[model samples]
Target: MPYNFDDEMIDEIREKNDIVDVISEYVDLTRTGSNYKGICPFHNEKTPSFMVSPNKQIFHCFGCGEGGNVITFIMKHLNMDFVDTLNLLASRVNIDIETKKTKRNKELEDRNKLLFNINKDSAKYFYENLQNNKKALSYIRERGIDESVIKSYGLGYALPDWSGLLEYLLHKGYKIKDIHSLGLIIQRKDKSGYFDRFRDRIIFPIINNRGSVVGFGGRIIEKNGQPKYLNSSDSPIFNKGYNLYGINILKKYARGKDVILVEGYMDVISLYKYGIRSSVASLGTSLTENQVKLIKRYGKDVYLCYDSDEAGKKATNRALEILKKEDVEAKVIVLKDAKDPDEFINKFGLERFYETMSNALPYMDFKIQLYKERHDLNISEGRIDFIKEIVTELKKIKSPVERDVYLDKISKETKVSKDSIKEELKYLPIRNYKDKYINKNNRDNNKDRIKPVINRLEPGYTIAEKNLLYLICKDKNIYESVKTQISPEDFITEEYKKIAERLYEYYENEEFLFKTFEKVLNDNLIGTLENIYNTQINIDASQKNKVLEDFIKTVKIKKLENKKVALKERLKEIDLMDSKSEGDVEKFKSICLQLINIDKELKLHQ
Candidate 1:
């Protein structure tokens, strides 16, 4: 449960805690003009680029582009969430916040508590079953899982009887519907009775951060079981996507060390058994955005040790994409002779696995190797194709020297001249050779060649949109006048639109204050707002109204122009059709009418 803090309360908490004083606890700061400068704690930099403005009560790092108010600074520096950070700052100032929950929230919390209790009881029942069943105990012992380790994970077993768990839970005074809702049991087709979901399987209870059982995972013990592993379905308190197996235990020993992300429950268990405490597994699914974010909270550097098979390689690629998108640095551990971490450890022992982890490939190198496997390098065409594929990845590299190094490696491998590859990459922004020559038909067809995407100057409407948002945030009256004509939706840039949305919402309660308005934005969004704030707006008071009017008109006209472009493109698409249906004809008429109206609006705006 989280405490509810209103804007006024947030303001008070912020005011009591000075940005400089709060940040000084974590970073060493020196006075520089009106602002303070310090080496950025968020990223590695020798020269100081982190600045804190006491006047505005905000901090920004030019190197990493992380900027926010005092609360945000604590959230990033300490790796705490908004609520926890706020609560911490509140405690610092000795401000007591009353825990208030809405009726619906209270009901939900109560339900979650009941569900946790049921899961705990069910886990205990399974654990007791494991102790009595000699076959189950032997199976686990054969896997080299010790009794202490089993107790640490709360590992258990479910009897083969269909209603074994059902009978036990019923005997313990738990209702059948409540038990079935947790996915521990399944209802019969005729709705006559319910049976246990986990039967003759080794049960792995999924514990959350608080050490409460939220879900269960079962691995089949019988040889003939169809699905090898079965997990609890999503319920009120458990979402498989939102959690990782063994993360609760891993957190205690992580200590800012690199995390090992594996593919299976046993992979994590095996690593932990070998004193590798910083490994966690995705809950029988592809790595998710939430799971990546969770990994980021614990540590930034991650080692992805998925299986070595084709499906495993695909999953590794998918995980890399997510981790890259989230800005978390990741490397891939390539295991030899073994398919997964569990087998690798068992086959080659722990020290060899450690050596493999130490010799993990950088993501770019792994990607290059993966691409090499996709095409034959012996033939000239295959080499050309491989070079093209590698260039697409190389373009993402920000440094020219780094890009050139990879290009040199590709040149040596494919026997293609480095200068020729450089030329192809030089024109890559305008044309994708891979797209142009994906297949024989496409290469033969010249029209399939992509048009040059010239990097043009920013549109006038984009500038106008940003300037208007800046002015609106500076003055509430300007926001009131602008709201009647244009909205946050009219803004073209995503960051500008987000600022407008927050600004509009904040103005409803109170007038603009830099520190107070900053409360509305998340950590990622604060940098954009700060950059906008730093921009020089030099319009004289006499010319302010006229400038605002011009900006509004330009934005409105640009919107109409966008609509016109879309309708014209739709018309071209319709023309390409060999035959038009009645619905298509009607759609064309509607588009033409809309375009005519847009033209009229454009004329008025001009």
Candidate 2:
């Protein structure tokens, strides 16, 4: 359920919480004249660039350009939502917001509480059963998990009886429907009564970051059990994609250290037992964007320690792609002579596991190794294809020094000169659209709510449009003057266009405020706004008009260039037709004429 708080109520919460005080909790701050200054928590910086103005009640980081009010700061730092932040702030000041809760929201709140209670009780039941069952104890001890480790992870076991858990929940006054809703019980095929969902399995309670048991993951005791692992179905209160298996422990133990991601519950447990406490699992599912975002909150450097198999490689590749888009750094820990992390750690002991983790491959190097495995570098044709694939991969590398290192490695492997590899990089058609605007609609999909990072290498026109927006934000007269020349449609990037549109709307209503602008923007757009706002543009009063005109012209020119590119692509498609029909010829001619006109317009702008 969604929260419903009026503007006045939100304002009250914001007023009760001071920006400098709120930020001070997370970052050390020193009094810098009227404002507070501290090292930025968002990015790595030695000097103090993060500023909090007491008068304006807002915080800004000159280093990373992340600026927002107290609420935005808490939301981003804690990875929380709008209402949750408000509630947290309100609680600090002893403000009760229950009066503002809607009926539906209140019902959801109560129902979630009940579900959490059910999961807690069910977990206790499973743990008690495990203590009595010698078979389950032997299996756990065989895996090198001691009694202390089991207690720490809240490990449990489910009996093979069909109604063992169902009868227990009923005796405890929990309704069958509610038990089934949490995936602890299943309805009979004949629609009679419910039975236990996890039978003869080791139960691992899936505790979220909040320390609440939201779901369960069950591994069968039988060696040949079908669907070896059983996970609780997603309920209103539990989403496997959103919650990690050992995140609760990771949050408690990982003190600014690297986070290790694994594939299974036993892997995380085994690693934890062997002193690798900074590890978590993906709840028997593939890595998700939300999980990546969650991992980012705890640590920046992520270590992927999945099984050493084909499926694990694919999973690692998928995670790398997502981590790349989210601008998160990742490394791969490939185990030799071991199928998974559990087996590897158990076989080699902790010292060897540490040695292997220290030698983990960077994501790009991992990709290169995968390519090496795929192609036969001994053959001439294989070497050529390998070089081509490596060149394509190298194009994505932003740092010239890092790219040169990889190029040198490729050169030594295939005996290809560095000059030839550089030449190959030049002719490889850059997938600009895919790289620049990948997953633009990811926010629309619930599976991937984390927004992809905006490419810093935007074209000149896009940068100009962003400057125009910044200028408007600095001076209302500039907004009035620029509105007449270019609207939001003129901005090439979707993020820029949306910000422009919001600026227009806010200015029209006379509601533009730097402190409260985050209200209208989502998390990603807020980041975009901070980048635009952090820019220092100094123009003479007499030259302001000229600068604005140049920016407007640059944006318009880019619009024409985009049209020209689309027209050329369409014309090429028409020419590639097997048989050019009369209509196709006419369409091709029309596109050519459009391209010519667009080129002329671009030249005039130039």
Candidate 3:
């Protein structure tokens, strides 16, 4: 199945970066010939309608009508940045992208690799030390961890000597510069040497779903160390906010069961040890938007088992904020008396931990209880404030049924009438303003792809420009006339110009119009092109001159209109960022006026 790319290593990378494989890493894909199908993971569905294609290297979901290629898949599924998707692909294909001389993608790839390698090497060092070092073994034994558990987690240790890891890595053929740059080693500014950053610690390798060690969590083995634990600094590949310590190992458990989210690695290990397998811990930090997205993709029901300590409760509130954003079904498990799930289990029993997991309180119910804990509800002011807070949050629920249900729960707690709550919601700033805007204008566009603005060329231009361009490539006669008469160079629209350039090159190569163009241009461009080719054409075959003249005129007009709109949008953006007339408002106004003049000129030309 692996096809040789004939020395086009980048091409090989691009080809291997198939939309199916990229998507399958996130979405559970079912094979359907050259294509695969799965339910659209971005949204909920009853039937499996998301389709992925390896041959064409595109994916489309008929249920949601979401469609795109591998890059778009990452952008949508992972909710990653553009450069991040490219870097992920490049890494998969083992491409060595240089940071400086290369383009933005390459530089990002280089930085990403440096960051990943640093974390990986650090994890390897930890694993090695755990296996060979006596002090680390003693530390593990003291903690009452069996050898089987340590080996299961692939745990390791950091030697007492600061230079132990540095020397070992250097001998293993890792570059000293990369080792320092990756934050695996601390380099002295006035000196020329590097030393191990994590010293005399029992190391835990933080793994991702693909099972690559992306970061390290080091526990102090020596009693003299001030801090008990030290985690790797945030890198491009590893964010403490986004990662879970043992999600890679626990993802299998997470897949089918309600996920049990614990606070620490010890908690996860303990839970797993007791056969409560569907448990994972956040990366020595609070839950983040990225982490929420990751968890939501894997499972629907989430149980948050944070430490019973004050800091853990604070972390719980912060995690609640992110999960609220993701709109997931989450509950909080209160681990009473003990510091965390691990200690709680060890102190009480696995039975108690299981009971806590099963009886995890609904996130809102927990928060409501938190409010009750803080305030005396019988007090009129306290009740009023509590009712107001509940109503405010309840109004944020767009679903009427869901809102009413929660309102009923609020009424049961605070003795507030449902009608009164609904009345209060009428005045609350809780409408889905973004959904309203998107619904109004987003009908023509696919939400899966991110386009700042939709195409809005005039009626006279749309049929001819898109049609002639489509037919020119399809039929040789049309291609010749267009090739000699009109070049993309003379087009007014920078967007259409780019489109035309891609078409021009494709036509020049005498390539077929369908799969060839789709492969060359990305999913967005391909969709646009397909729309051009497939959409209803209004012009007759005879009206070449009239169509050309009208197309040219509309293109210019649209360009001017777009420029004016952009100038207006930019002025508003500057106003917001400046928030006052901090920068040159007059300069922005000047551009707006110039845009207006261009519109007038376009009108005259038309």
Candidate 4:
């Protein structure tokens, strides 16, 4: 059901949910002067560049240019839609939104409800089958899975019979097509009948963030099986790339802790049983950008606990690249003398696992170590090659202090001089180093040119427009007076013009809060608005009038200067003609008069 929320109801929701309070649930904000500061959740930064203004009810990240109000923050942070964010906020404020469901939406909702019911029943059937199947139960029990742990995780088993799930679903009054759509049963290719998807395997029901069973993953109990693990194919409700295996439980425990990303379900389940609850795994696939984004919603830091084998290291490297691209603070956990987390925890116990986690190497350090082992640092050529590769990796470090620290480490390990390493770092081009590691053939040709950092400063006219908007946003009286003088066209930048237009609309509706316009603004415009709001304009009540007057004058002067340039160009065209008509002469005369008037306006501003 979709709700048609009126402006007043939306405003009421915004009024009740304070931006600072809402953002505090995800970001750790500390008071810094008049604003709250934290590491920007949208990107990785050592410094606290993410600022939230309680007075203005808006947040701005000076690092990544992510800015918005409460609802906007939730939408970006949680990767949810506008209506979903509104409903979530409404729930927080104890407001029930009145929604009308169309026939199509109602049917979709009913179908989804049916799918959920089918998945739930299938999970129960598998669980009961687990208890009756001695071999499956013994295999699970031998792997250190207890009864309580099994129940908590909804661990189950599929009987060896092919028609086990098919017969059960039919008896439960679920259509075969519905069960097939849920990935519980597979339709026969010959169109003869349907068969169970999972048979003779231990089942792990995949639950979504909303606590609904959406799919399943099955693993063979016996060794040397053809396929070790089988997962449900992609369905309407389940996207393995977007959802983590144990995130439903990980979200609860990962509030203030770093999430441990493993490669298998047993790794997650075992770690959870060992009392390390902040663990999640991708569903039998490689790490993805969407999954990384999902992990970021819970915490900024992540620990990659994949297997320490050759393939595992490659997977870990790939995951590191994805996490780095997503601006997530990631570290790699290397387990010794064990195949995976399950075996490591079982062999070394939880204390040693904790120690290993505490001693996990930073991503750069891990990469350096891996490269050192790969290159023969015993010889001069090997050392030179290693140094070049390490310097390339070092250049990716954004913080000067962190880069220097690693430079010292590389110097100590390779017996190379720190000065020589620093010199090499200075010469290395600022290319995407992750691409070099991920794809050797995809290296950029223009690696000698340094990549420029994004500039946050707007142009002169843009600055004036933003200043004027800031004034209008801060004071309602200023909004009315400013609106009367300057129109949205006065803003030179298109983004600023859009913001000015929205501000006028909100002001017309008597909704003064900047948050009231968040739902209507895009991310870039929201960022612009936040930057404008966050900018400190040192003007008293008496001086505010003068400042607003000056800004308006500057905008008018810029507009007039643009008009003068166009008129002068037209005059040049008219002069270039061999024979000018009487109307052309009159037009040239009109342009000259307009240019003179524009000059006078510019002089007045000056």
Which lDDT tens digits does candidate 3 get at residues 216-275? Answer: 777776677245666665444554555777777667666766787877778888887777
Off by over 4 Å in 4: 1-104, 430-606
Candidate ranking (TM-score, best to worst): 2, 1, 4, 3
Q: Give one digit per residue, the lDDT tens place, for model 2 in 70-181.
A: 8767765776767687889999888888865566457667988998999999999999999999999999888778999989989999998989988888899988778877
Show how many residue pairs clash in every candidate, following the order shown: 0, 0, 3, 0
Candidate 2 runs further than 4 Å off: 1-101, 430-606
TM-score, cand. 1? 0.56
lDDT of 4 by residue, 1-606 (tens): 123454556677888999988887777799998999998766657989899999988887766556657876886677676677788999998886754225534665787799889999999999999888889899998998999889878999998798988898899898987887666776675779988878888999998777899889999887543356777865656656668888888777776678999999999999988888889998765677878888888865799999888657767877887889888869999999999999999999999998998999888988998898779988989999999888877877999999989988889888999999988888876442221111112223444655454334343456678888876765454676787789998887788899888888876764354334555787667656756765434442223465578688767867886788889999999999999999999999998898888888776665
Instruction: Please state the error at residue 79 of candidate 2 in Å.
Output: 21
Clashes of 2: 0
Which one is best on lDDT?
2
Cα lDDT for residue 150, candidate 3? 86
At residue 23, candidate 4 shows an lDDT of 83
What's the residue-level lDDT of 514 in candidate 1? 50
TM-score for all models, in order of appearance = 0.56, 0.57, 0.54, 0.55
Q: Write down the RMSD of all candidates, one decimal each.
A: 18.5, 18.7, 19.7, 19.1
